[model samples]
Target: MIAIGIGLHNFAEGLAIGNSAAKGEISLAVLLVIGFGLHNATEGFGIVAPLAAENVRPSWSSLVLLGLIGGGPTFVGTLVGQHLVNDALSIAFLGLAAGSILYVIIELLAVARRAAMKVVTTWMLLLGLLLGFATNAVVTAAGV
Candidate 1:
């Protein structure tokens, strides 16, 4: 489920990347890819958290499937975005991604509360948000 949420989010990110490139904003597109690559690294942790928290080691095959679930959409989204560029479409994807991520955050908060590390978790959450925003700042500065 976490993977699915992050996948949706990544798909939107990929859409942004593809849309930028489609419009000939090569610099912005490159910036988006760079920022998103960093973001994707963080999302890998999200996908693995349940396994780690439960002390359940995942099989290599399972890991591969989860990776595809979480990361494949970005590739698909880029393909779609390259050919179909529309503000409304992009907004729809972003909205879906936001909702999906919100659900995952809520679930993570519950998990953290169970571990009685709410304070530390809250700070970690804030740091994650800040990192995301800081990355976005770079993309925005590039005029995308």
Candidate 2:
């Protein structure tokens, strides 16, 4: 489920990348890829969190499939945007991503609550937000 949700979220990121590249915004496109690549690194952990928690090692084939599902959209979006960039399409993709992320966040929060480490979990959530922002700051500093 997390994989699915994050994959959807990544679709939005890809849309941004695609649109930028299509418009000849090379710098912006490169920045988006760099920023999004980092974001996706963390998302990989999120995608496999449940498996990790259970001490289950995912098979190579499974990992491949997951990677394709989560990252393939970037390639597809890039192609589409290169040929036909539009605001409405971008908005719709982002809306879908937002919905998926919201659902995943709720589910993860429930899991944290069930673990009964409310204070620690809350702090971790805040820390994650901080880390995400820090990453964004780096990209912003790069003139994005």
Question: Which segments of model 1 are wrong by more than 4 Å?
Answer: 25-28, 137-144
Model 2 clash number: 0
| Tens-place lDDT digits, model 2, residues 1-144 | 776777777776777778778777787787768767766776666667667666799999998888788777767766666676777775675576568768767866776676677998789789877877887778778776
Residue 32, model 2: Cα distance from true site in angstroms? 3.0
Across residues 119-140, which tens digit of lDDT does each residue of candidate 1 receive? 8998997997798788778777
Best by TM-score: 1
lDDT of each: 0.79, 0.72
* Model 1 residue 126 CA deviation in Å: 2.0
Candidate 2: Cα lDDT at 42: 65
